[model samples]
Target: MGQGARSSWGRLLADLGSTLLEVVHGRIPADRPVGGVVIHDPVDEPVYPENSLVLAVGVHTPDALAPLLTGAGRNGGIAVIVRSPVDLTDDVRRAADDAGVAILGLARGATWTQLAALLRSMLAEDDIGHTQAESLDGIPAGDLFAVANAISALLDAPVTIEDRSSRVLAFSGRQDEADASRIETIIGRQVPDRYAQVLVERGVFRDLYQSDRPVVVDPIEMDEVVTQQRVAIAVRAGDEVLGSIWAAMDGPVTPERAATLREAETLVALHLLRVRAGADAERRLRAELVSRAVEGGPEARDALSRLGLAGRRVSVIAAAALPDEDGDASEQADQERMAARELLLDALTMHLSAVQPGAAVAFVADTAYGIIPVADAAAEDRSAALSEDFVRRISGRIPAVVAIGHAADDVAGIAASRAEARRVLRVLTTRAGTRRVARMADVETESLLLELRDLRASRGETASGFLARLVDYDRRTGSELVNTLAAWLDNFGDVPAAAAATFLHPNTFRYRLRRVAEVGEIDLTDGDTRFAAMLQLRIRRD
Candidate 1:
């Protein structure tokens, strides 16, 4: 017997004959498989094995069946067979129907041990036949489509293969038998939100992630859009759930069909692992190319060409997480931040690609950098909008700052774009209450000032001597002369407006401006001197 074999409740009851057991409340799940048999004991705790047909050996009262069915369903049992003679109630029947658990009656003189042994032998023989048939002419290995088609053929149902995130990876092309939810999922390449919510409320996904067996979902209690039963088998690699195979069933799942689905899961897992490996390799190559372009290596232009961005106009963007206000520096917090950054970068890459094909993104140090090709002048605006949208989506989840550089003509201009983006990011991180999305063009004046400041610092130059003396005079006398000077310059030398802005009378502001000239020993009437002093004051504000 193959290890993957299963037996249906109807077949097991028929094999036992009317002398052993009979259908009572709920009909046998003709398609639902029973992998094993368990004898229910009142004194001991119930053990609900996966896909098992449970035999309630002693108690068969109507009230007992309600909790029994509910508990069995929760524990992943397929059906319950009662050995007692008590009559079944409507409430019990309804509960069993709602939970999708089948109920059966064991006739007098049928021992639990005897029924269990008989079931094992029958299932073994069933498995042997199935193993032989599969070995002869079953679905070929390593073919995801063939696997889906085979499962659909064996169960006479529509089938879909999806990643763990409920993204549809493939479908059996049997749209004729598909429900609205299934069709929607296939067309959108993702499970619809309403349908996904239903499954989550029912704890279907929890079971899928926690168990190794196929989970049977009853459509009767589900949304009307889901018109058929579903059996979700997790495609696993060791302990990891790679994806799932969803089969839409018109009726209960039979053991033969269940075994086929299990086999299909194995095949799908292998295919997913291969697909994931290939995708990872390609992602690595693209990330490396972006990294090279950002760093301005000699190979950058060639790398950009390989990524289909050689002659295209492109913009570079830098994204970094803003520091937490509370300043958590624990190891756990660090790990969490790293994971969040990676997730954000991945999302950015996906969104950028959707907006601009062949967009390349990479995470370097604490920042994520992307080289995005712009189709035309309009594409630059589109890229900026997309970047803002991405930032908004990730806000609160991960507070991040995104800086966009100006677009340039070709791959050769990528380095300059990246430098501009990095410069904008630097200023953004230092300032409080900066907008989440910063553009180089918007901060051109600030960028130039920052560059000039850096140059002065490298040359070991100090602040303008005249501005320094004005600052010293304010410090000594506790006066507002330096602030008045900054305000006057900021207002383009408008004495009244600057005084109004400073909340001082015009005559008082004029008096401070005169004091500023005497304390600084400079001519305030010169435009070039005012310009240089204003720049100095701006640079030292922080």
Candidate 2:
């Protein structure tokens, strides 16, 4: 790994220091490379890579935090963040200094989850296993924070680079010098809705996006978030608007600075393109690794290792959107289906990763498969519950089916688990959204019947014996005898229930049942007769 392998501690502060965090104790080891982010769990200690940033949630006092800091320092941790208004007492400061660990204060309103996500994003861009690409203009490719800071220096003002939706992608330091609203935006990583509304109504976005020149805007009169006027320009790649740059300036147009802003826009465009390309590359590589591990061969172990799932017990989940067979057969419809599949895959990836740590979700052809690591015996049951929850969460948006397989205790067993999941999925997909989440144990009967149907068809077989007779009679007479028998069997010989199900009178249903027995030569009394009839009906095509 080179010096650029990861963002150093100094860079973390320079990027996040203004709004999200503050240094409360110890020197900021600016050059220390933070390897990863880890949540502190007392019962199950986390494995901390070198220079880990430990998020010590709920440890607030001097007595409680002192020992944890020592432990973290011994494990090569670079810093520990505690919820703010950090105690910062003399004793706590002494402990942090003694442990050689810096203490950071998380903003009072910011969530630990959001902080972790931000840190992980930074770390992933400089992951240890992959070599860092050479810098493109003295700044690392796709390093938006560095670009934002450089642009700020060139313009001599606090700046922010934002997506078209007004979500802040990156910001330079000295945000406090801008406005209360600017500070709020920096804290939330988004322009407040009131400010966005102000901009929208003023035709600010339309004018800025339409012209290459910087558009100057009057000061907004919203709450604390809007006291300063802003100069904004759209960042574009050809005709596509990638995002925009915003600077809080004291006065009006300087031609040279606006020209610099235009040049900076081109650089930001390149960085955005690189960021998108990197994400796609990472996704493709992950899919390949997941495919290899699920196929289970000599290199399966290596794939599992790369996925961080080696030596772990796991269950495979297979999920897909129910096909809209009745939808219009147009190019637009096809694109909609493809988009739906991608949405399902993204939801599965996010929800599963939340449910189980280190889970891997990826697409293999038309199906999206998830490998969820488990520590308990009821792996499939737990997976089913999570899958059901996910399906319910996205129910109205997309109708989907999810199948969970038995626990695979090792990498060698994962392939079998995936096969079982896919087998169950095949049965569920045929059922037309009847059951959205099912495990092999829950749908084994349906799966077995499907296998039987496949085998019988391949051998050129059809309905046999009494079932054949019932089917033939129904076909010739255009009667409901076959359906009558099915309803009777399904209702466990409850005549009135079967009658209601078929929307017929009880006497009519009873007469049909009698006809079914007599015309098909089937005795409705024998257990073997009922079982054989049901099995044949389940497997037969006609």
Candidate 3:
């Protein structure tokens, strides 16, 4: 039972005790029935006459010196005296003081009012203590129950809870079978990525805090109605935000609905704080395990298992927001980052039925890091078009630069693939800007071309310094050796053809060729060396 329930019982006991005292003291009329059950106020079902005479007991020498007697007095709804006795030590006095229970050491025994005050104080302490315990679990069940019950009572509508991550945790009222099934489907499932991202990046907390108004979102405004319920309120705890509670009802919010929602908001805030604490602890633990997996090599497999992504092929994708991009740069405003995380997870499950899916995707306002699974070429080759189509559709909605990394065949190379993909992403950001796709293999050419251009740009740089100098020279003169090399390679290393095409002489062409080998510090005579250099120059040209 909740704290509210317990307090109610205590109040009932206090009432009973008061009535007994009145009867014992001959304060009530003999005609008043004492043994019959009476009910009043249908809303509360108070179960007694409002005008019943209250009773008093234990008047002298710290009445009810026994702890049990003190508790009994509370249970019986009567007031008792507090006088010095063997059991009423200094510690007891202090404890009573802490609980705000006034001790009446009445020389003429206790009065009715004294007993009533003691009962009231003890009852309040019990309720507050219950609240403190709820804070420990990250779920203020008592608070939530109060709010939910209040809302139900006020609006006659059901309310439900969703956590920081936007997953439904529980319901406030009895739901029909279909609604229950829908609730079951959503419970424990993550909140939509877009909404979560919006909340995180957009100062949604501040908005929620600054206003007493209810957040009203329509189905058309959201673009998709995934749930039957259409309303939600974010729960907050001081400066911290915990989660939200959504309600599904058949009609627009009436006065009763508004009142209930307001009360529910309070409970939602407290409960959200409690649950978030627990979730935060769990998230920290999960993050630690993921970090260990990234560092531990084979032992990392254990960590992968902990994340539920062990022994699977992995795809690491790197993406970033461009300065040219419009809208929010903060995490809260970047729905794309969050949406990308969700779409990837959902797509994997929808597309690959056989493989167990595991992913770790991060949304960092301006950039995103993702590690997911892609089955073998045979499996994904056929689906490439479909995946590409999916990406195109999404990209059309949210402009971004996305580079997919080398897909590691298994968990063993997930780390290496992620690193390579990140490097590719960096180059893409520098070279391709935003709204482009880059492959890791393609970046090598860009890097090399950049070096060659640097060498040629340097005045009188030695043949040996050609490639090394290319990098430095380009920094100085901003010339284009990589493009020149690309032209040469495209002509199959034909000097005359390359020179003619580049609008340079045969002598200059030969000089530049020799310099290319010198500056690159590698022999072009070797097929592997030539291929590497040629590949680098060509890719950069493109």
Model 1 scores a TM of 0.59
Best candidate according to TM-score: 2
Candidate 1, residue 77: how far the Cα is off, in Å:
47
Q: Name the candidate that leads on lDDT.
A: 2
Model 1: lDDT to the true structure? 0.75
* lDDT by residue for model 3 (401-449), tens: 5566676755557677656656666666666443366666657656456
Superposed by TM-score, candidate 3 places the C-alpha of residue 294 at a distance from the truth, in angstroms, of: 4.1
Q: lDDT scores for all predictions?
A: 0.75, 0.83, 0.49
TM-score between model 2 and native: 0.71
RMSD (Cα, Å) of model 1: 18.1
Candidate 1 C-alpha error for residue 323, in Å: 5.7
- Show the lowest summed lDDT stretch of 10 residues, model 3: 19-28
Per residue, candidate 2 scores C-alpha lDDT tens digits across 1-542 of 22233667886687568757888888865777778787998889888888888999988888888888988899888789998877777877787888889998887645565466556655665353666464646788788999999999999999999999999999999888898889989999999898889899999999999998899989887654448889999987545687999999978869998898988887887677567646755787788788988889987888888899999898888999887878688999999989999999999899987777799999999999998888787765677788999999988998988988878877668999999999999988887646888888888888888998889889998677888888888889899888898899989999999999999999999999999999899988999999988888766632
